[model samples]
Target: MSERVLIAGCGDLGQRVAQLLLARGDEVYALRRHPPALNNSSIHWLCADVARAETLSNLPAGITQLIYLPTPGGREEEAYRSVFVDGLQHMLAALTESPLRRVLFVSSSAVYGEHGDEWVDERTPPAPLGFNGKVLLEAEQWLSTQPVRSVVLRLAGLYGPGRMQLIERLRAGLVHAPRGHWANRIHVDDAASAIAHLVELREPQALYLGVDDTPLPLNELYGSLAALIGAPAVPEGPAPAGLGSKRLSNARLHASGFRVRWPDARAGYAKLLDTQ
Candidate 1:
């Protein structure tokens, strides 16, 4: 039987995941506040905000799977909680009657505070240094206690098509990084693919780190990107505030038989810059 999937907080990444699911003959339902005006027959678009429970009363029934990836509107703590915590609560409540088999909650690697030069994995204890991480951690914990099958994917920084803020910064000679700070990222497409892979896994683990195979130093990444775009040399700057330097491992994700298309940031950025 084709699985009925509900993508809560559907956005760019959600749409990519929807495409993958649709290609494999699964029923895809996309939910968002202001849906696009595409007249596609494959995807069913629903209008609702996960942060507001009242707006989600009319969701479709018999949804076999769900993907929750809500983006906050602001950087404040309340904003994070409202979207990640409250929004998830409201969405789950709305889907109470649906036969949900698995839920994929997209989280962030920020949950593992600063780790200096250490390598962190799923077994490492989380000590989020900022409200963003704190709020996400809360949501993950809350979802774990629910009486539903759920998987938490703590993703690294996402970069892919149309997400060129870093490249732009490097081009303008305004980008800098600490001498020894480490960086981790997963292409947006890989993130979507990981979600699709986990959704279909019969015996999936409760948690997994969604990152690529490579974890580069911040300075190295900046330098490579600068050279790739023929930009001026990147300057040395302080590490990102609240995000401590640490290496993230994707060993578990790889062992699960899923591979990423872009494993290194240099290669990913090079491919993206080619079109410019």
Candidate 2:
């Protein structure tokens, strides 16, 4: 059956998910504070700030599925809270009476603190080290208490198409990575597909880690990416703050039957570099 889906805080990832849902003949209503001109004409765009409850009062009725994919304005606690925790609260309150069946809440793997090369999965308890992960975990817990069914996908680093900040850094000799820290990532396309997959899944689990099959050391990842793009070697530096060394496992998501197109970051980066 076709579904009427509402994507709150629709941004890059949300737009991608909308395209997938549209291709499957589902009705997609995307809500954003300032919606840009869309390439897909079939998408129904709603201009509203998820952070502002008043603006979300008239969301589309009968939204069978909801995808919350908001990006924080800044790295501060207030910024994360406004978007993830408060924004989700307001969006859900507005849709309190709608026929919403499922919510695919886009979260981050940062919720798990440093695991020191240990494999972390859905079964691992979350120990967020930064305000970003802390707030997201709070939102996830809050959503679980709601009456509606929900799926929280804690994504790893995203790279693909137009996401070339890291590549630019490598080219500029500003790139650095810790030799011992681990890194996890997922291509943006695969992340979008995972969102679409879980939304339509007959029976979905409560939480899943959205990541590629391969987990590489930070230095190795940077080195390979630099070589792939014919850029300068990356310098050994401190690992990204608050993103502890950990190898994330996507076994549960794979068990659910959704396959990633870019299972390896090297190949994924190579394909992306080819177009450069």
Candidate 3:
């Protein structure tokens, strides 16, 4: 029996997960607002908005697995709540009738508010520094109460492919060495692969911290990237702070039998530069 997978909020990462699921012979239904331009025969792109219960009328029936990875539009409190809290509530209600087996919810590492270089894992309590983390934590709480088997991956700063904000900032000279900061990231492909791996697992833990083995400080990470692009590295000095520093651990994710293709920022950035 083929498992019918429903990917809610099917954006870039969702698209990659869809490709992975299709390649593994699963029936994937991609739910999104603007229709996706993908041409996979095994995947179905349904026009529906997760935030709006009215639009999710024709969802595929009997979804065995659910992937909820909605990207809130703006950086405001209302925007975050609308997507993470209210939006999830609406989707959960709509899917109550469907036969849901498992759920893979993509969350952010922003939930941790620590600014120091402390190593945080799945067991560490999340104290989000801003509304972003607060709302995501709310969503995770709601997901935890659900009856379906669920795995919530609190992902670190995501980077790869068309999502090259770090590289863009470095190239534009907008990013510089911080006085001292820790930046954790896992390549976007690795993230997608982890979700795909969990989908195949007969049993998985309720939560896993998603990040690479390396947790480099801003100065070293930026320095390596600067060298790769042949750009001058910024000297250590006063830098604006965002998402307080903390080392995110992925030991739990790795134990699940997944290896990152791009282990660190240096290797990942070098791969991107080669393609440029």
TM-score of each: 0.98, 0.97, 0.95
The number of clashing residue pairs in model 1 is 0
How accurate locally, in lDDT, is each candidate?
Answer: 0.92, 0.92, 0.83
Task: Give the winner by lDDT: 1 or 3.
Answer: 1
Best-to-worst ranking by TM-score: 1, 2, 3
> Model 1, range 1-276, lDDT digits (tens) per residue?
679999988889999999999999999999988998875668899988888889999999899999999778889999899889999999899889999988899999999987878999999999999889999999999999999999999999999998999988888898888887899999999999999999999899999999999999999999998988899999898888899788999999998899999999899989988877
lDDT for 163 in candidate 2 is: 92
Off by over 4 Å in 3: 37-41
- Candidate 3 at residue 51, lDDT? 77
Q: Considering only N, C-alpha and C atoms within 3 Å, which residue pairs clash in candidate 3?
A: none
Q: Per-residue lDDT of 2-102 in model 3, one digit per residue for the tens?
A: 68999988889998999998887899988887875766566788887777888876677888888898877778988888878888878777788899988
